[model samples]
Target: MSHPHSRRVRRGLIALAAVGGCALTTLVAVPASAAMTGSEKAADPASCPVAAEISQGYHDGHDGVDLAAPLGTPIFAAGPGTVTESGPASGYGQWIRIKHSDGAVTEYGHMNERFVNVGDTVTGGQRIASVGNEGQSTGPHLHFEVHRDGGTGFGDDPLAYMSERGVSLPCTP
Candidate 1:
């Protein structure tokens, strides 16, 4: 039998690891069945982006639709656009920004990895980045923003914008 002190040390170690792991990756718990995906990978949902309910919406000054997805889930470009910004932003971790044909720019934030770069042109539904728990994110998700009138901050509601284009979310924002 192990000493009492050794047992206590083992338990302490396990507890510390658990806390650290939780801090590193916020599991955006969206059930596979509850998420909606327009991509062909629906047959293999594991590779798709499953947007969860907007935990935080525009009204709260969140500025984007928080789509809770698994870490590394591919984030597709919402429309055809030219990549304007790619890489880390203050609170947006590894992010990507695209300027669409409408002169409006969209930003994808908290990405684990980015597939595009500044000045690169991307098509609708093109893979741009993977979901992650970066920046101020409490959980792994894609913080997608739609900025209109060539502005920064105070953008349009991403849910309404994407919904108009036919990308359905599991819950209303």
Candidate 2:
């Protein structure tokens, strides 16, 4: 029989591949630029950006959607963007913040590892890091957020916004 560790590794690989496939499809379907709203038009999703609903729940501060996934599960870029910031910050443990060409910014926090460095261009659904429980978190999860350019304010609700665009999440608990 195969070793348990080996089996685990094999499963991890399969999971990674599945996640990658989804990201690739999301990138193609969204077409980065065409999916952009007024502000996003300048940036376009083409740079490869997409979001993953890691967990499930609700939070007022989070604008009412909670993504709950296992620790170390792959986290994908919501759309194509540049790694403008990738490091730890107050409240957010290991994190990566990407700036899309469309004057919008996406933040991924509670990361266990950062796969991409600052200044690197990342495509939507690309694996940027593993979900983690770094700072101010109760469990291993990712605190994802999006902000409009010039920091005017957050745009639409991330949960509804992503769903409206055709990205769907598995039922979470």
Query: Whose lDDT is greatest here?
Result: 1
lDDT of each: 0.67, 0.61
For model 1, the stretches where C-alpha displacement exceeds 4 angstroms are 1-53, 170-173
Q: Choose the strongest candidate by TM-score.
A: 1
Each model's Cα RMSD? 17.8, 15.7
TM-score of 2: 0.62
Which stretches of candidate 2 lie above 4 Å from their native place?
1-43, 46-60, 63-65, 150-156, 169-173
Clashes of each: 0, 25
